[model samples]
Target: MISDKEKPEGTPKILPLCYKVAEHENIIWVCDGAANVGQIGHQIGVLLTNMDKARMCCTTAVAAGSKPHLDIAARSKKNIVIDGCGNRCASKVLENAAVKIGYSIDISKYLQKVPTLDIYQADVKRIAEIVVKEAHL
Candidate 1:
């Protein structure tokens, strides 16, 4: 069994998508900000890729001026933008580019009335399911 600290040696860690990207490779997907505000978006990104149901384009890729990544995103037939907080960095990227996002999920909305910055596994899964439903995938 793989411990939390160990990944199969040859396994390619998920690329942060900062460089080149395959042409129109993934269909249904997300472009996460992957920021450290609360890690909610990062957790959602891991779940998004791990489930094998969708793809993720990192905000870093767009920020770094990767045309292929931007092209892929702009042409994507479907996309779910998940923002970690009201700052809306990830969503703003799509909007700025005029990329039509099919859906948007903001992690801050899931916060309790008191509003804490912490999020748990269950919260991530719940948000993922919500995205899956919204995207109809």
Candidate 2:
């Protein structure tokens, strides 16, 4: 179990249980790749989740064929996919599993892709705002 002491100061001590409440949640799946856009996409997911606008789930688990995660995606009210670039890796994972995606966006459209993990909070907020408006979150 995760302890509050282990989490960052401003982070939530406990988050909404995504699996148990997926049917009423807008689930976010982001590509956490080794690039600026990818990192920004990930932060955007986290931002939306922390703001209670959506819940970010494990795209890696879905890619690895986790049945529980796949079921959660299947039952979610909306699946919001955020991809780093034109690759659309996160979206493809859900599509391959036959999971319906209610909303999807490629971060490259808003930011230039760079081969670095470093990202800015400003970019995250900017992209997150776009997602909230576009995805109707």
Which candidate has the top score in lDDT? 2
Candidate 1, run of 10 with poorest lDDT = 18-27
lDDT digits (tens) for residues 1-137 of candidate 1: 11123568899667534224333333333344334334766776666665655566666666566777678777665666777777777777777776777777776687542244455766667776776677675
25 Cα displacement, candidate 2 (Å) = 0.2
Residue lDDT tens for model 2, 27-46? 99998988999999998887
Model 2 worst lDDT window (10 residues)? 1-10
Query: What does candidate 1 score on TM?
Result: 0.69
Give the local distance difference test score of model 1: 0.60
- The candidate maximizing TM-score is 2
What's the TM-score of every candidate structure? 0.69, 0.91
Off by over 4 Å in 1: 1-38, 112-118
Backbone Cα, N, C clashes tallied per candidate:
0, 0
